[model samples]
Target: MNNLIIETLSWGKLEVTEEQIYYFSKGIPGFDEETELALIEMAESPFWYLQSIKNEGLSFLLGDPFIFYPSYEFELPDNEAEELQIGSNVVVRCIITLKEQVEQSTINLLAPIVLNPDGNVGKQIVLHRSPYHTKHCLLQEQPAIDGKDGG
Candidate 1:
């Protein structure tokens, strides 16, 4: 049980285990320099913090896409799956952009962060010719069950 102390802008110094760290060989888009990151699960929440190990200020809030978009689905390319050495266990998360108004928050569905827990490797994949986009409302209103406008 190896423990590592990392500094974060939001939570300050955090003690994380080696298993919590993920290596992105190609690095995340717009943050190519950051190859190593710590995935910290938020307690009692469907969100996680992807904190950079080298840069304390660099971090991203990630969310379970399915929690926000139940019907969200995508086909992972075989090459990508092989590149990450993915077997059966694969974790998917989307980067979330939180706004002052909670309702205005958006999640990036176009580029999803996929991880292979066993290998401790991850990659942000960009889906092509897909219906999803970069910014999808995080808190979308569910359709009325009665098919009424709720007038």
Candidate 2:
């Protein structure tokens, strides 16, 4: 059932689908009131735009943290997992905050958005005592090359 919804975003107007809509029962930390969000794919990129259907101005740039941080792992508490009806095949994504320089972009590892692909239910869960931080730089500074080593 692909129900088209016309929305005006920062980039311009877009037509989203029903399957693309995600419902967050408890809502995200900052945007608690805005529960309905549309997961729009970014053209030619792995990133996705989680736009709020309730508010045109609210949207977030999301990314699959596992793509960049292969070793990244977080345990979902039973309570949260049960609430979202998520099983082992859940999709986990983190919010990406871009800086002036693209290389300086950071992902919010402390909190991750977990979704049940089958049910289309999603929730942003904040880890209670995780080692991850909100600003883990995506790009590492390049090492200086020696001018004498011409070989």
Give the alpha carbon lDDT tens digit for every residue of 1-151 in model 2: 6676656468677888787888998778877897888888898887998998877788999998988788899889999989998766798889999989788799998889998877889999989889998888765453555776656
Clashes of each: 0, 0
Residues 10-67, candidate 1: write the lDDT tens digits. Answer: 9889999999999999999999999999999999999999999999999999999999
**Which regions of candidate 2 are displaced past 4 Å?**
141-151
Q: After superposition, how far is residue 120 of candidate 1 from its true place, in Å?
A: 0.4
Per-residue error at 63 for model 1, in Å? Answer: 0.2
Candidate 1: list runs displaced more than 4 Å: 142-151
Query: Which candidate has the top score in lDDT?
Result: 1
